[model samples]
Target: MSNRVDELEGQVAELRAAVNGLTEELVETKDRLRKLEAEAASEAEPPAERETKSDDHVVVVEQEQDDVDVATDSLGSDTASEAEPGEAAVEPEETTENDTNKSTDDIIVA
Candidate 1:
């Protein structure tokens, strides 16, 4: 029948439109991936083009490290002087065998 033939043609047209939409999305995604790869390549520095710090830079770093060590040593002595004479460090009480047996003997849930 002509009616059935026309219905089939309409379905075919919808399938073609769907395929075209998906094809366009695939092309755009591929283009975006290529651009990202190119950008990453440009940002990378090759080994031959790498720069090194001079002797002055090394000396400056050593002086900074010495300053840090002196500051930490001063801080350590301050903490040692701050401990109170009355406050002793508390240690946990040692568990007895009877106490362990009593605890594990019963479990109460409320």
Candidate 2:
């Protein structure tokens, strides 16, 4: 009976030590998980902040497109005004008098 009690006590002490070790490991693992989560959060930027940056980029692109369109329109108007008025005129083939009066040199001028 005495030997059996001693064996049982030894087993109980070993089990208690194992439970303590498991509890300590669990606490450490939880701390590590918390630290990892915090690091991940610090590295990440919020979606709304990223969207604001993208919105700024979109505005800049739109402004550039508007400037380019304005510049092209002004350039086209300037070139059109610079063109000679007589050269800008388009006549139909049915305008018989002008076609007949045209010199051969002028007909092939283009």
Candidate 3:
């Protein structure tokens, strides 16, 4: 009877240690979650404020036209040859049954 009691006590001790370890891990996880939520809250702005701030900011981006042409040409797409430097390629409009009924006056020129 004493041997059985000793074995049960050993198992209880192991269980206690496992429960303690799990509790510590859970606490650490909760702390990490709270920190992350706080950081996210600090960084986020209200929608109205964000929109107003975005309107006040102007972003300009510049890239060389030659670099674009080189990348396109390397990809083996015939786009580079279709248009000359400083010119845009004009595509011919396809004539469909619906399009044929539309008058030329209805088309707007840019």
For each candidate, C-alpha RMSD in Å?
A: 14.7, 19.9, 17.4
The regions of model 1 sitting more than 4 angstroms off are 47-110
Q: Which pairs, if any, clash in model 3?
A: none
lDDT of 1: 0.84
Report the C-alpha lDDT of model 2 over 1-110, residue by residue, as the tens digit: 99999999999999999999999999999999999999999998744212223564463223345567888999999999899877856776566666668754366643
Clashes of each: 0, 0, 0
- The window of 10 residues in a row where model 3 has the poorest summed lDDT is 46-55
Colliding pairs, model 2: none
Candidate 3 per-residue lDDT, tens place, 1-110, comes to 99999999999999999999999999999999999999999998733212223344764444466766777778766766666798866899899877776776588899
Highest TM-score: give the candidate number. 2
TM-scores, each model vs. reference: 0.39, 0.42, 0.41
Between the candidate structures 2 and 3, which one is better when assessed by TM-score?
2
How well does candidate 2 score on lDDT at residue 72?
97
Global lDDT of each model? 0.84, 0.78, 0.78
